[model samples]
Target chain A: MPVRVAVDAMGGDHAPGVVVEGALEAVAEAGDRLAVLLVGREAEIRAEVENRGGAEDDRLRVVDAPEVIGMGEAATEALKRKPDSSIHRGIGAVKAGRADAFASAGNTGAVMAAALFGLGRLPGVLRPALPGYLPTPTGTCVLLDVGANVEVRPEHLVQFARMGAVFGEFFLDREDPTVGLVNVGEEPGKGTDTVKEVYEALRALGDRGAIHFVGNVEGRDILRHGADVCVCDGFVGNVVLKLAESVSTILPDLVRAEIGRQGLGADHARTVGGVLRGMLAPFDYQAHGGVPMLGIDGTVVIGHGGSTARAIRQMVLSAARLVEQNLTSRIARALADDDAPPHP
Target chain B: MPVRVAVDAMGGDHAPGVVVEGALEAVAEAGDRLAVLLVGREAEIRAEVENRGGAEDDRLRVVDAPEVIGMGEAATEALKRKPDSSIHRGIGAVKAGRADAFASAGNTGAVMAAALFGLGRLPGVLRPALPGYLPTPTGTCVLLDVGANVEVRPEHLVQFARMGAVFGEFFLDREDPTVGLVNVGEEPGKGTDTVKEVYEALRALGDRGAIHFVGNVEGRDILRHGADVCVCDGFVGNVVLKLAESVSTILPDLVRAEIGRQGLGADHARTVGGVLRGMLAPFDYQAHGGVPMLGIDGTVVIGHGGSTARAIRQMVLSAARLVEQNLTSRIARALADDDAPPHP
Candidate 1:
């Protein structure tokens, strides 16, 4: 059976245009194996589809979602105020089982709020979290609670560890991914009271074979890929993600300014800039695509507001993979067996 | 009178060699206006001074500090165990009025612990914090509590702002430097429970003209230079600082890898790498020198463990400036009347 995906076409900075093109691309690539419900203003989506000249696919259906919640709107107020918004309607499809997964590049808060209220949390989960995919030199690592629970208890962190590990296994396609608690130091007794408690809990969880908890990791560890899954409170995680996102822009600007300062000719500068961009390709958000709201009862991925057509296409594929992998059930089972004694 | 500065010659990775060279440079430049007390193993300090030639400077004195504290040792325990360590002796010089200021490139925790116990806190200060200098496109911004006070309250953050502002004014040489609270979102209401309270306190303080509080700033603000001083609890600040420090190394490596992948000739790669290194000069900790532990009763600066001769020289010069400007008194006065109504 085809795994149907709902796309928030009205969401994102370049909404409808890139979203439509991306949905069309996913439908074309996946053929009959995947079906996309483009949820947004039908007229705008149709116009975008027509502009792209690929409107004849049966697998791609434009489902009318008249309202549009802005990128900066308050999640709860916007969702309650605009019931027909793309984020709401898109998530509604997942809740109703019309679509196996939901994806959006809209307001991250709204997407998360919608997922929580509509899909609810999986069993054995304390709090849901947004896991941002960071591209390290070694490959990719997951930094969770990127914008979810701003204040998390020790138990919430333990839950994040289990969920993050499962997601890491799928994303990295590696067994026994290492989980780390992001802190000021790598020692066991480091960090705030909450982090200390979480560290011990994670240690206990590791001993039980539920996860490969690799002690504590500092901020540099994220880029160093010291652990496959790095977890922290949403407040810290969000700040780190934003800073990392800005590095792509800041680093290149510094390089360009340097080239100018060195009095390099325009021709040489162009070649150097090209090489620099190629080198920084790994930092591209479009390549990483969407971040999944882990612990949700169903698959729900949130992309950057400035997502390109390529990013949207990648998010759609990622959603399909999560569905096929039965992420929610796997996470539930992992948490359920967390306390059982290790098999002999 | 000349400003007397105590240098922790046994601290940092390079130890006596770089410390001696840097001290000599500072003394030579400052001439009779500066005096340096090199606190470490007397024999080792003398050997390094002789190895570098120019050992006839009368302003540089070698003070014997027989004991040493390893960087990885527990801060409080090490400080107690190694009473004769360079960090302890350096701060002792400042406390005893033999030195006007103290500087160290040793274990950061050890330096902070020694400063707190030795010099105590300025009047009205809630807690002392470490302010890390970050180079931006415009100039430098200070991020405080970089590794001190990992868990802080609203009042502590307010104190940080007042102290950081005083430091920023001197460091940036700009009157009324802007102070920003590092948080997940730019909105005042966004962040953890502690941050929300801090927002209100900072706002009230700003309204009274205690500081030029710029509401909230995200992680990107450090490089964006959104504010002259960005404040956060030590836990978050330390993480951000370390991650930013890693970028210098990571970015250069990525460029080299890209050059190799592009099949660029070795000659071309070397030239490009040189240009890249020059471009990244601002990020060099050596140029920024030491991070001052603010709110302390005396001027105490801590340098990176991997500091070079240039960085040590800068730290010594920085300590002189702090003493000359009476930074401790300025911060003390800033927080003393923080609650007083605005002048008519």
Candidate 2:
């Protein structure tokens, strides 16, 4: 059966336009292998599609989703209030097995709330995690609970590690992905009680070949490519994710300042900017498209609100890959094993 | 009385040498204005001092503290087991009224532990915070609970704001520094119950000029120079601190990659490197020296393990500024006020 993916066409900064463009791009690239259901206000979605020339591919379908959940709206309240929001309706399609996956670039909390309430949780998973990738010189590192379940239990962290490792193996195409528990210090006894317990549980799982535990890693290790996957409570993970993002925000100013410091004029600086842009491509957040909301029963990808058409395309493709690999089922199978260490 | 500052000469990675050089540099710059007590193994300190020539001024003192505490040791256990460690002894000097402030580039947890047991908590203070400076092109921003109290209550966060605001005024030389509560999102009702309550408490206090609350700030708000003082529980603060530090860690390699992409030889790249380093100097972690351990009874500065002689010098100068300003007393007075809002 062709893999079906639901797109939140009303989500993100440049919503219907970029989202529609992205869905069309993915269909063209994936050919008959992929089907995209653009879910949003029917009129807007149609107008966007018509603006870009009618949806020429039979694989592309527009589903009427009348409400739009804003980027800054309260996730739970908005989800409950706006039943027809692209996020809600799109996620509902995945829940009902009409779509194999769901993707959005709107409010992260709303996307997660939709996953929790609509698509529902996977077997043996208490809290799902939003896992994002950070570019490292060697490749990429997986970091989760980036913005899902901000207040997580110790056992929730263990589940994140198991799920993150499985995701990493398929996503990064690596075997027995090494998992590191993020903490204040690298030593075993450094962090809170929750971290200590999670470490012990991960260690137990590692001994049984369920995961590759790399002991403790600090925040610096995430970008340093220290492990295949790094797990932490969403609070800390969110801060790390944002802080890494700031590096991009500041670098351009630094380069401009450097040109000024060297007494180079605006024209000279603009020429230098082109080269610096190429150099900075790896640091761009949009390159990754979106981060995945894992531990849910269906594939769900949440991109930044300012996502570009290219980023949307990347997000659709990523969700399609997870769907093809049966990532959610793999996570469920891993968490279900009796040999898996019990959460604290 | 002349302000006496105790230096942990055997603390950081580049101990004795950088620590001694830093102390000497601070004394040379301050002349008769400040005094530094180099506390560590007397023989090693003396040899290092003599190697660099005996103290140039009487303001520099070398105290005999025979034991040393390693960085990775558990804080509470290390403090109890090694009373003679420089961290314990230096803080003790402050407690005994022999030293007005203490600075260390060693173990951070050990420094906090020393402040808790040695100097003791200030009256009306529950948990202390470590406030550090993040340099922006415009100026510097203050981030507290950097790594002091890992887990904290809403009241402790309020305390952090009061303390951090007072600090930014004297340290960054701002009047009524605007305070932002570090959170996942900037909206009114984002984040956990603890964050929401802290927002209300800060708001109530802001109405009274207890703090200049600017509402919630997301992770990206930091480093963008969003607020003067940003407060959060130490766990999230620590992650932000480390992730920012990675910018310094990775910038060199990134510059190298860019130069390689430009097809420049090693010699040309080295020349470009000198210019880039000059531009990147403002982003250097060492430029700020050490962050202060605020809310304790005495002045305490905790620096990075990878501190250099210049960093140590900056650390000494920073602590000296706090001692000169009577920062500890100001914080004590602020917390003692009857109108101070109770923890939510």
Candidate 3:
């Protein structure tokens, strides 16, 4: 009855070492409720698993993958050429019903392609979205299409909102998540023609109790977490995500240097620096491993290329939680209900 | 002859008090090189100016404006109805050649409308952009059309890039400022159709030695000051601007809270907080008083609604600097040159 998560052991920056370590950690921490399928070069992954003190019980398994998708290679190209890649094999396991979910710290494009091609998109879901959780000054908020669908239509945005709402309900435990369309301004007539149309659609959807729509939210609101779910085209969402990460990295370092120049005591300076670092550290996607490709037939979490043991552990844990909560099923049901016409 | 700047004394959140204080500060700091024409309710401004401990010096004068523009009113409506409003009067003074520039911390829309109507746009300049100096992680960079020209064409974007370049040269003192179009990606075929066309135009302009065109830059590059000037439609630019401000405000608070819970000394915490605050403080546009509306016939700096005395002082100083730099003339020359067809 343990939630089984298939992890691409050869897919991340830290590779077998971090993936193995993370799997062990997840299994240990999750007790008997979590199982991990380490899919990679059999001999290498086996050695790594043994190095990490071996699996606690039958809750762990090793699936061999002959190849890997490089971080720099085009994701779609790599998926076609490298069918035996660990990321591909891992996703296959989930689709084949060998694993409940799949997690990878590999190329995002490859993971998305593999998930869509391997498992397929759910009903009424035109495109899958990479939904990311950003910690804001007020609280944490979810942003969809962080990098998944680059060119999206009004209908795509509607689906993203629905998927994001479902994810938030399962993860953040928010009842009737307040959904907001990320726009240039809060005004109704702001942004491009696509945004305007989407705004109208979202407004209509909200009126019918599909979701608790909060209307349009500006860029600053992305970090403010003014709404539980924030939906935008992948281009905008990706930009927002990258910018927030860059700011988190650069601003704190600048602040620390400035503070150090002021001749603050070493102990105090380090403590303050530590505090600032912790506050910003979460923004680094490596810590969260990867983003989840929502609206797919099965749960798939994409990790960053530079993910480490801790990040991988978090990814595994996230995957298990997604499966346990039956997030995909809930999202599919919502989409189905949305597609159905209203009765008078 | 000292550069004269008209101040809308009755505008902004801390109006009259802050505006008067800032004007006096600018006059005192700039010595005889600058003069301020404070336009507002004559009695209120005089009382505030008198309370500032400086006598009615030769460099400072007050003009009577019976009405004031409210921040909530639409810009076009406010400008059309309140002809004798403080902002309108200040702009009128510039039009009448009584002042070299006009500065206001009133409603941005109103100030923009008044400037366009009174001062008029320069030749070859389709729209006047509101450019602000955003303090990035690397250094300060210029972001154009933060809220000006919301619906922009490819031609408008080219103009924005040119205007931003001029701004960088005048304020940042860059000899050959590098200009970039803010897009979702750095690839040649990234972003929406609008951005792609602008990219091609910029490339063509860059080849002619008009400006150092740096191709496309993502949101992360904004705070990095990757280029001297960052150009985008008003919507995207405004989003970036507001997001940066929000991050600047929230990041410090998060750090402070963490440090506080750790029971760090107040002085040490303040030191850390101060550094974080300082990095973000420059973005407090109100602190700097006003931002110049580049490419206009005369100088115009739009201040924040929450402007204080210090902000007004900074705005006054900025206005004087713009006059000293001959920003408007330089912008006109650049625009004329840019509009010319390339040589074989």
Candidate 4:
């Protein structure tokens, strides 16, 4: 059976054009293995799908959702007032069992609100986390609670570690992916009381051979590929994620300036520029498609606000993969199976 | 009339050799305007000075302190155990009115301990902060509380903004440097209770024109030049500093890989590689020399653990600049003049 992913066609900067186009691409690429439920205003979505020559495709369906959620509106307030909004309708499809997953690139808080209110939390899941993935030379490093929960307790961090491990094992295809608690220093007593307590919990799990805990990892290790999952409070994780993205954007410009300063002729510099562009192509967030809202009852992948057609396609594909891989069930199992101590 | 900077000769990975050699370079560069007090074991300091050809310079002085603090030693524990340690002796010079400032590349916690316990906090300065500077394309961004105060209150954040402004005006040479409380989001009520309170306090300061407060800035803004100074808790600031440094280090390799993927001939790729190396040269931590510990009564610059002679020289230069500009008095004035709300 094709995994049906409900996408908010009205979401993100690109809107119906890129979102509808991306769904078409994902459907075409997956052939019969994937179906997309485009949740948004029926008129724009229908026009976009028709323009893209996919109006007749049985795999693509448009769910009429006339109301919209503005990017700047308060998420919880918007959720209550705009029940017919794309975010609400899309996630609602997942709750109603009409779609296996929901994906959006709209206001992050709105998406999180939709997931929390619409689908509710999974069994034993304290808080849902936004797991942001950073691709390195060796492998990918997953940072959890990127923005889902700004204020976190020790147990929440431990839960994030477990969820990250399950996600890593499934996505990276690694056996027993290592978990590391992000801290200022690698020492045991480095961070605040919350972090220290989390460290002790994770460390105890490692001792019991329940998890392959790599102890404390500093911020630089986000790119070091030292561990499969790096867990921290959403505030820290969100900051690191944004700073890293900025670094990727700034690095290329710095490289270009250096190339210009090399005293090379314009033509030669242009040639080198093409090659360097190809090198940095991987760092593009579009390549990863979207970040997953992990630990929720249903799968939800959040793309960048400025998501391209390909980026939208990637998000749809990610959602399908998660649904097919039984991500939610596996995460639930992983959490339930764990015998680690709770908050001290 | 010379500004004397007491440097921990025993600190840093490349110990007495780089430290002594750096002091020699600073002496040569500063002429008679600056003097360096090398604090370490007398024998090693003397040999290094002789090797660096600065044995004849009267501007350079050797202060004997045989006790050494290992990089791995617990800061408070080591401070009590090794009273004769270089950190203690170096700061002792400042306390005893023998040196105008101090610089070290040793264990960060140990240096903070020496400063707090030996010299104590300046009047009205609740806590001293380790302010790390990130060099952006436009200018530099100062981040405070990188490690000095892991546990920070709202007042501490408000105070850091004042100190950062003074440091920026003197060091970065910016007129009325802008300040931003580092937050997960740009919205007013986005983060924890503490962050919210800090935001309100900083916003009020901006309104009063007491400080160039830019409200809340996200992680990506650290290198955006949107604000000259970014304030956060020690934990977040430390993560950001290390992560940004890692990105700077990792960006080049990623770029090279990107260039290699273009399938260019070995010679052309080599040429491109050389250009990139030059481009990324500035991102090197060694280029920045050292970070100044702000909000203290005395000037203290903290360098990286793996400090080279060039890095050490930069640290000394930074310390000299701070002293010559009378950074302490300026910070004290900035805080005393502020009309911001106290901690709730």
Top lDDT prediction, candidate number: 1
lDDT of 2: 0.83
Please give, for residues B81-181, the per-residue lDDT of candidate 1 as tens digits: 88889888889999999999999999999999889989999876779999987778778888988889998878888788888999999988999999999
TM-score of chain A in every predicted structure: 0.96, 0.95, 0.94, 0.96
- DockQ value for model 1: 0.73
Could you give candidate 2's per-residue lDDT for residues B1-344 as a string of tens digits?
55788999999998988889888887878777789899998888888888887663569889889999997778788888988889888998988889888999998888888888787778888888888777765778988887777778888898999899888989888888899999877777767888888998899998887778999888887888778999988777777777776777687787777777778666566555665676668777777788777778889988888899888988888888888888889888888877774453
Order of quality (TM-score): 4, 1, 2, 3
Q: Judging by DockQ against the true structure, name the best candidate.
A: 1
lDDT of 3 at A191: 80
Candidate 4 regions exceeding 4 Å error are: A341-344, B56-58, B338-344
Model 4 reproduces what portion of true contacts?
Answer: 0.80
Per-residue lDDT of candidate 3, residues A183-275 (tens digit) = 877778778888898888888888888889999989777788879888987877877777777876676667766766666677767766777
TM-score of each: 0.96, 0.95, 0.90, 0.96
| Docking class for candidate 2 | medium
Instruction: Give me candidate 1's TM-score against the actual structure.
Output: 0.96
Give candidate 2's root-mean-square deviation (CA, Å): 2.2
Clashing residue pairs in candidate 4 (N, C-alpha, C atoms within 3 angstroms) = A279-B258
Residues B1-344, candidate 4: write the lDDT tens digits.
89999999999988989888887888889988898899999998898888766674558889999899988899999999988998999999999999999999998889987888888777788889888888787767888878777788889988888888888787678899889889988889988888999898888888888889988899887887668898999999888888877866776677666666666777777777788678656677777688777777788889999999899998999899888888888877777774643333
Give the C-alpha miss distance for residue B269 in model 1, angstroms.
Answer: 1.3
Candidate 2: pairs in clash: none
The DockQ-based CAPRI class assigned to model 3 is medium
